[model samples]
Target chain A: MSNHAFIVYKKEIKDMVRDRRMLIAAFGFALLMPVMMGVLYLVSKDSEAEARNTMLALSNIHQAPGLVAFMEKREIDVVEFEGNIVPEELPGKADALLFLPDNYGEMIKQGKVVIGRLYVDENTKLGIQRGREIGSAMDAYSSYVAGIRLLARGVPAAVASPIITSSYDLGNAGFFRQFMGNMILMMMLMAPFVGGLVVAVDTLAGERERHSMQPLLAQPVTARSVILGKLAMVSTFSIVSSLLSVTTLLIAISFIPAGTLPFAVYVNAHTVPLIFIQLIPFSILIAATQLFISIQVKSYKEGQSYISMFMMVPMFVSYLKIFGGEKLADFALFAPILAEMESLGSLFFTGEVSVSHMTSSILVSIIGILVLTWFTSRKLQSEVMLDAA
Target chain B: MIIVKDVAKAYGDVQAVKSVSFHADDAKITTLLGANGSGKTTTLRAISGLLHMDAGSVTVDGMIVADDPVKAQASLGVFPDSFGLYTRLTTREHLAYFGEFHGLSGTKLDAAITEVDKMLNLSEILDRRTEGFSQGQRMKVALARAILHRPSNIVLDEPTRGLDVMNIRLLRTILFDLRKEGRCVLLSSHVMAEVSALSDHVVMMAEGVVCAEGSPAELIARAGEVNLEEAFVKLTGQEDNGERKVA
Candidate 1:
């Protein structure tokens, strides 16, 4: 690189440091990730606790003794009533209402099961789901009750059962950790949009808007040098934000008591380096993508809009993964945001990643960076930068 | 010295410059006179290696600039019509930036800075950032940067477009000094007075082609006009003094 290239790079970095808005935006993004993760963790923890302690209102109290006994045994607080449950009294009164018809026991006794109704508001879905778990326990108890009655009449209980089976998870130690890790990794992928957007926009589009790009482009330096310099600055901010987000997540998980749930939520010291290694390429790809968008637009606002649209792609991909539980294939590992999520998910939950998968994911990310850099360089070569739109 | 041999540039279907040819010798100011969209700026950009010519070549100091732009551009200084300045950089830093591009560093960089600053009369605002500079100040700073490396050839496109009358005179004086230094200075302007006053050689362009070329007095005498502007209008066969009417 020539001194001109270095001067360009130094000038870009200096400008970024001087601009209060860009600095705040970068730090704001870093701070935002931790705060968001912390807020989400708090919300999830609170909801889980609330769900476990939820109370249910029961109607038609006299219909089933086994279910009542099962609820008491499981420490489920149930209030029995004779009529319809009032919606107005639900808040602070019960988490949900279970309406058992008068003929429910009769239907079951006659070997004809009837469907039970659960009345719940939107806010009570989690609690209601937990409350409904009592029904499963009741089913086992009712079968036991029927077997006892059969024994009283000298019939074998085993003859009344069709089959018996037990379930055991075949997943490894890191399975649960990997699942939680995927969520963290997804959050890290999102860091680039939050962290890299402001810097990238300010570097290219902002310069153009300020009318400073012409002199820079006209300098004796090559376009590649300019792009590399800007990309370096953007990636620096992105990596910082990603690391901060991961640290905040790990700290939040540490506050949770051990053995509280199925998944290992804590961030282990051993995994930090590996996670960082995996994340660097992901951040590079995201930074390059945002830079490409910045280069295409004319002003900072347009660059911001372009980056916002680009950000939606990764977010939508993450949403699909979370809600759809899409299975990852070899080919899917080459997809940008999806690949990051999958690799991270595997790294966290399974603690074992196939070498081929890791190689392909990194390859795809590097390829994305290369393609975006090429595009930005090409734009730098155009008269569009010199010609105001 | 600079040489243009049958240079042409196009944008898709529109040909901006059509088989244009001219030569600019050292120790003289060569001004390109034309109406709006007459390919003056396009020709200057082509010579600066900023635009690719569809046909022909631009050679600066015997080095082909357009075909191998990096090498070609290294030997020339270009001051665009509406150049941008880094708002945060002090005038000295701006000069230093361009000076470094031409590989001037250490004592050499310092000497270049001192010389350009003294010549451009930018010593007053050398330490202050350029964020608050007036149009004329900015233009002076840009000119200083263009000549910081003391390149063999200098190409300026409408360098005095927005300057005040006093600054315009100052710029003309500087151009004269550059000509005396035996450096090839190619300037494009619509202002016929400045062109007539400073140019030793004038090339009149019309519709992407050079219609006339000679000394200012010679062109004026040949076109049977007393002033350069009348000679330009006569040579190009266009009226309307190239001025914008305020509403």
Candidate 2:
């Protein structure tokens, strides 16, 4: 940095340090968000484990003693459900509710099909797993009765059910692991934006609102120096916030028992630094984009409106990659946020670097920083900047 | 010396300054005397290289502001119409911040700060944050910020707008001292008494045009008027008590 730019940077840092609110917003989100998300991951993992050992409330258990025995064999503790129904928020006490018909016994005796109802809230990973386990158990019981009926008529079991199907998962990770991986990447990608937003708004737009832009611009320093200095200050917040998130997340990951988390997070000596290397330029890129947005507006409130919208780029792009990634083309991976997600996603989940994706991400970030900072500097030179909003 | 030649500026549809031309010489106090909306601020901004004139040129110390603004700006100290200050920064820090841009730092910057502090009588408020400073205090800090680098030329856009009588007197004295030091001091104001008392040369502007230019007494005599205010009213063709024209 030029001495003039450094001077501006130093002054801006001093100015920002005194704003207790901006410091709190920048640091608090950086330091706390990763830990909170880590705790959430642990809880989700626990819920998945709990789903395997969940209890089933089967209504009319007396009428279906055979089904009760089969559920117990599957290691599910089945209990009677009398005058009860599942609420929308599935209670943790019972993972699933299986309703049996009052005439279950009579229907079986008369060789008529018996109707039953199973209630499960499939909102959470735990609920989905619980529903699958209970449904599989009930299906097994039904098959058992069908096999016995075939034997009584001297029809071989193979004749009645010739093709017994079984499943072998070809995918490496489970549904829960993929979802967790997507979310972790999403959170990591969002860290810089959340970290630098308040400070960036306060620096440019807030300076204008305070009417300090006039005097600053009137100085002998060029607009380029002023913007370069401000960009560095904002990037300090961005990079610090993002690195803290990674650090805390790594710390949180250490608490989990080995091999319990579905995806491997290869956070070792080599990759840890690489993760930082990948994130630093990305953070600066985000800071530059924010400064560009900030210079367009004349007040903090106005700048925030635009910058907050820019923040949604990462989130919306992450969600698009998570839920609808397959529908997107391969080149879309080279798109802004998607490229970052692809590169960082590989580093975090698979402990490998996709060099093409990573390089493109970094190159694009550097170029973006140059372009944005240039545009912002040019904008700062406008005569309109002489006045405040 | 500072020079503005046929400077014309417009804000979109509104023509703010049609044509303004003046010369402010060194070792003299020149005041741009005009009413509100007379484009004094616009012309001052143009000279400070803060605005782009649609027509004409402004030069500070023989350097064209439009061609090389940073060089021109280095020769000029500008106090804008508003006292735009960062409330979170101390008065000394503000001085350092602006002073550093002019290539002042370390002991040099400190020395400049000390110099301005004494000149502006800013001892008591130098270390305090300007968050809740009164108008007088803000004016002092702002003036100190503008002149800390000791530019050869100074341009102030109504520097005494909201100051108390004592602060105004202090500001006038500072202008006098700067002029004595051989620095060209150009200021704008709508107040007639301030213009008559302080201006060694007066450039009377109305509707963005220079209606007349001379010593205050010379202008009164040239317009055949009793005082500077009536000279302004007659020369600019404004009514008794308004910026609007009599016709």
Taking the tens digit of each residue's C-alpha lDDT, what string does model 1 give over B1-247?
9999899988888888987899999998999998889999889988877776789998888888765777877778889877588787888888877787778888999998899888888889888788889988999889998988998888999998889998998888888889999999999988888888889999999878898999999999999998888888787777586542232
State the displacement of the C-alpha of residue A221, model 2, in Å, after optimal TM-score superposition: 1.2
Please, what are the lDDT tens digits per residue for candidate 1 over residues A325-353? Answer: 54655576557777677666666655666
Off by over 4 Å in 1: A1-4, A47-54, A59-70, A80-125, A144-181, A209-211, A251-262, A265-269, A327-330, A350-354, B240-247
Model 2: residue A261 alpha-carbon error in angstroms: 3.3
Per-residue CA lDDT of model 2 for A1-389, tens digit only, reads 99988998998889888999888888787678767777777777764456456788877888888888878888998877776565665445677888777888888877678878888878777778778878877787888888887888898776767777776778877767777888888888788998889989998998888888888888888999999999999999899989988888888779878976778887788788889999999999999999999999988899999999998898899889878987999998998888888988888887899899999999999999999999999999998777678
Q: What class would a CAPRI assessor give candidate 2's docking?
A: high
Docking class of 1: acceptable
Name the best candidate (by lDDT).
Answer: 2
